[model samples]
Target: MSDAAGDRDTDRGRDRGRGGSAPFAPHEWQIAWRYMRARRREGGISVIVWYALVGIALAVGTLIVVMAVMVGFRAEFTDRILGAEGHARIYPIPVVQDDGRRVSAIDDYDALAERIAAVPGVIRAAPMIEAQVLVSRGSANSGAVVRGMRISDLQDLPYVAHPELSEGSLEDLTHGIALGEGVARELGAYVGDMITMILPGGQATPFGMAPKIKTFELVYVFRVGRADVDRSRVYMTFEAAQDYFNKGDTADQVEALMAHPDLLGSRANPTEADAALIRAAGHNRVLWTWKDANGAFLSALDVERAVMFMILSLVVVIAALNIISGLVMLVKNKGRDIGILRTMGLTQGAVMRIFFLCGAGIGTLGTAIGVGLGILFVIYIDPIFDVVNFLAGGGIWNPEIRMLTEFPAELRWQDVAASAGLALALSYGITLFPARRAARLDPVEALRYE
Candidate 1:
């Protein structure tokens, strides 16, 4: 037994002799990495290491997915709302009430519309008049907004794209009237029903109180699925609305639609700039972007994203804790080895760097794993959402159609970069405590204890 022990030590001495110059190399990183690998192998990359990695990975992936889904819901819902309504509406300044009076403007609106359309990134620009009116079919009465639209004006807008035809066609839109599906259901009126609409007339008749009453056959019924607009929107021809609202020849406002609804407020694109310019025009008109139109919903999405990031960052923090514990264990297990290295003229900083390399190795490995999982889940998110929706009985399949029918996803490189950078930074940050302790070890005491 003694001879075997002696031979073992002799062979260890020879191996150490052969590799003595390894640590003296100019490329300290290469030498430090080699040493770190040897120590990590000795410490055993156990099942616990894998569990820690998986935990971090799952946490990061789930955070990313949840954030994306929230974003998807917001984006999808907003598009539907914008489509049903219109993007960027311009209303004349000083909105008049329903008093018995008339507000008149002699502005050359056709020339203005032409000039507005010529603005870069302005896709479609059209004049509109919106008025609240009480619509009735028989004894059933429903309140709704009567919007006057020109077919040629909003041809490029998404509101008219694949519009759900519950009753009459788009051609009949000018001749008769179109009722929202929800409105039709509530009023108990169908396609061929004639309805009476009462608008608050600006002029008082000589015989007591008065409001304008007009009759029209319900020509079409369209469903956009937004609860607010679906149940309260009634569409009429420009001429019909003019006579009803007592505007004679003028519309109350103009509606414009842009290309991308996502880039608003923050990004200064030409589309947003043009919308601003039209708003800034001295025509006493107020221009509103989609952001302004749906500020509440958009703000909710932003708040949720920030909250999710703050919550998920805790997982990275916990992973860093595990790294600290693991490195401390390694230092305790290699106490005698560190003392010997110190005796062999390894500086305190070098000792600290060696341990730092160990912790960094774990961080690098775990970060790679987490990032890989996040990417994989993001790539296959649609299928995953479908499965989830299918199992959940498709509760959101038709979500008021304020957005999109299908689940929409967009993987931004900026999000990926931010997540990966945070993970790596947190990983590197936790090693300092353990590395400092390892560097300050008393060589005499460590050797004596061994």
Candidate 2:
């Protein structure tokens, strides 16, 4: 009889451990799970919990998508800017001529360029001559920046190579000029067509002033994607530019390429290549970095990114508040159970844990669903946009303004982790007050009301 009684007691303990029948046997988690699975008539989970879950899921998904787009835009703009310009440029301090007029032409630029090229982290250094010229084709005329570059240097640049030649070969570029797509369009010029270039600094003629005019065959038309570059830039051979501009053995600037272009800055934290260029060029010379050229624009992008994040985060906060409301109601509805559990020797901490688990379960499940949805949405974003555009009946993307047909999205794991952590923390934080209230409920009063 004694052995059978002991066996029966052991069986009952095992049942309670597995969350069968017993409400409390030092098994707070079992009670929590029961509470979550309970029906409305049986005092189980409430409808408000589902509402909180949906809210959190949507908020998390929206934040992820928005952040991804913002990152993509920044990356696209940065790449375009870096591709069009060298990492840094070293310009000679304007020299005062006998007439006291300042000229930007750098004398002995080859020796200086060689010195800059030898610097650590410096990939390559090239001397370039830039001049403003009037370009005319037939009746159309426009002001353009004529860049004189060596054939090898031009070929090496990513931006120059990025464009496909609609007509003619790069070899022909040596004998003539290469016009950007925008410039060609504006001037109504085409490959094999002759275009006239007039330099503003003219030679002294019998008359007042005669601008030096030269006609060259346009051998190539290239499109670098950027509208400004395409419209305003014209490329010519280094020697040809020098002769046309009346500048002999001199360049307007020395452009330096760095192994790490992002390190382009004016401060002491500059990369070894930048520091070497500054040291070699001396204080009298002006060194302009890509960052210096686009500081304000980049700063604006950073500010916009931060503002967007803050604004979108409000959605998550609101969703977290819903968790608080749902949990508070759960605590009220489960007061009788809390009283019984406490009377059965469940600690206050255990009571708190049960409610915490309930709220956290909603948060965790919602966040997981949201993250999955966000990833899928980002992956299929292009196709989704195309479908929407098709449904709308016309072109939603403006080719004139947007270079890309589909919106860009870049997903970073750090962003995902941060977002998940924030949501979880908020959910846990909001549950604390209600959980504490449930823990502190007096058994007698709770049972009296029940």
Candidate 3:
């Protein structure tokens, strides 16, 4: 080769390090991979790197599992809330009485509800009368919320109307009352049993006030699958409620069901755009979506999810830190070898890359293993939860308190990706300092005593 060409080649080699091969070239990878395998003298550092891999794997797996559970919570709660409360509620603007009492009497709500139901994405809009009362049958009693709707409108409510979601018959719901499964269980009432409803603060008498009392036959029972709700909801006919509550011919509010309940919100929700359409359909009085009531709970879950992730990521960070200790040891042990390579015209870049690759190898393997384990955990969450409950001798979860009968998990790809990416990034990022140190080691100093 010509002297000028040789000089150019040498300059390029010096700039890149070692053979000055292409960025992450085959030889560089080969050398890096080989260095990852430890010799007997380097056994201590090899063990540390192994620990790092395990640590990263465990951390990532935990992150995925925790996030999945949080997602599951949001999902389960959302499902139950929508089924029980519907998507949106339309209330008449309350008028303040002379005594400063707020009274809601939605006049002519039937036609208005039909108009709202005709809006895009709306499934059902039923005019309803809702109030709190005490229910009793025989010797048992419980507090309940009475929701009064027409038999036709009851058919429009998803959980209440569905044959699978409810038990007994809706044939006589117009004349009798339908109690929740839990309420029936508590009262030991049967489908044909008579149940008495007591409304407090009723009828101005010689004393303060007297309670209004009424009785109706139990026609059916509904199991909404949510403990708190199933135990408290009681359904009666709209006409019966009007007479019982003495509300004349007016209703309280209109509960509107959407085809996609979970999507009704601001924040890029698909149903957000249809909010205007529903309002423009006919009426736009006191309207509130499902999110308004439950938003605080969901927000708390999100904050918890994020906090848990940040806390769990420390495990991966600590694991990556282990790489630094191991690499530092390796650098100390490989001082003589580094000197020899440097004297032989090995470039600093190659030396740095070699060590960087070592850390990357561990991070990649660990992240993959963690991701796999997390997915498996989420898939078999129910069985695992049962086992855990058994180990704890049962009663680890209360349906009435937690509002769910079973433990839930939902694996999301974004969660997995975020976990893996974080682990790898920490692994790779932590590698740089040590790798640079190894590359910058002066040949003369490295070999001075050797």
lDDT: worst 10-residue window of model 3: 266-275
Give the C-alpha miss distance for residue 129 in model 2, angstroms. 0.9
Error of 3 at 230 (Å): 1.5
Between prediction 1 and prediction 3, the one with superior lDDT is 3
Index of the highest-lDDT prediction: 3
Q: Per-residue CA lDDT of candidate 2, range 215-297, in tens?
A: 99999888766666777889999999898888888899998888888766765346565666889886668788888877777
C-alpha displacement of 248 in model 3, angstroms?
2.9
* Sort by lDDT, top down from the best: 3, 2, 1
Give the poorly placed runs of model 1, Cα more than 4 Å off: 1-48, 81-86, 94-107, 118-121, 136-141, 163-168, 184-219, 223-226, 258-283, 340-354, 389-408
List pairs with backbone clashes in candidate 2. Answer: none
Local distance difference test scores for all models = 0.70, 0.80, 0.82
Tell me, what's the RMSD of every candidate? Answer: 7.3, 6.3, 4.2
Q: Identify the runs in model 2 with alpha carbons over 4 angstroms from their true place.
A: 1-27, 38-46, 164-167, 201-203, 267-273, 388-406
**What's each prediction's TM-score?**
0.74, 0.86, 0.88
